[model samples]
Target: MANIMLTKDQWDALQRHLLPNPFKVEEAAFLFVKVTESGDFECVDSWCMQPHDFDYQSAFHISLRDETKAAVIKRAHDTGTALVEAHSHLGKWPAEFSRSDLCGFDSFVPHVRWRLKGKPYAAIVLTTADYDGFAWIGDATDPVRIDGLVIGDVDRLGPTGLTPLTWGPWEDFDGHI
Candidate 1:
């Protein structure tokens, strides 16, 4: 089980971007992380996607513009950092990936891995109260659940009941960003 470690200030800044007030719609961001020798992801910095970064957005979904995707990928490539995609969910839904999300990952994850020459990729879904995430480690075909989060000195475990799983080859998935 792997974990992500964030400094107090980094966690606070990320929370602010993901759960901004007047939060009528979902938001997305990318956390640039360094893969430590111990196999944990250490947060380096974050890029909060702005409104113009998305080609489509609603309270339930979002699609990033191609240019926005390109820019993030470029930055990650140049900096030799792994990317953890983070997004918000309105209301109080459990922070699990939706079916649409899995479908999207089938395509996007492979593409990103190819582009980045196989750097690990991860995604996290967040609501006001909870978060769940998974990561592709090494060259594994399936992802392992991200087991915990280290915020400053406090180590918080992820929600119970999440198991490692493979995302799919589903056809016709209209996904959120």
Candidate 2:
């Protein structure tokens, strides 16, 4: 997977925007982060969706309004940037895309890519403690898995600290299949 670099500020901004109620598990949260062109690999702006803006919501599910989705696409188009659509997993459990999350991605991700001039698009499931991410780098049937995440200041590990013999269940799980 392509590496995504976030400055200390960008990482902090997303953390705050995504988890308004970090301890609440009643509904999933969602946001879209626009980042620089893949080659530059930097985060730029983020748009957080409020709970009341969703059409569907629950501890394990979420659906944004059609308008919100359109807005995200427009922002990417206007800025010539890639977009990372991230959501919450609600607790201490490791975060990975769920079955329904994958299903929903299959339906909309391709379209979002097409509108963004084929720029890379990513999905992230974030929890209070950690997150797992996946990206569609170039139209593959499945996404390229993000092996590790590095956020400046917030999460810092040397190269060896990042790589390992095996990733946990989230890395091994693919509910879509």
Best lDDT among the predictions, by candidate number: 1
- Model 1 has an lDDT value of 0.83
For model 2, residues 84-133, the per-residue Cα lDDT tens digits are 77777676665656666766776698898888777777766777777777
Pick the TM-score winner: 1
> Across residues 1-177, which tens digit of lDDT does each residue of candidate 1 receive?
578888999888888988989788889999999999888888998999999999987788888899999999999999999998998888876677777677767778888888899988888888888888888888886788887788888757574334238654555644534
| TM-score for all models, in order of appearance | 0.91, 0.75
- Candidate 2: what lDDT? 0.64
Can you tell me which runs of candidate 1 are displaced by over 4 Å?
160-164, 167-169, 172-177
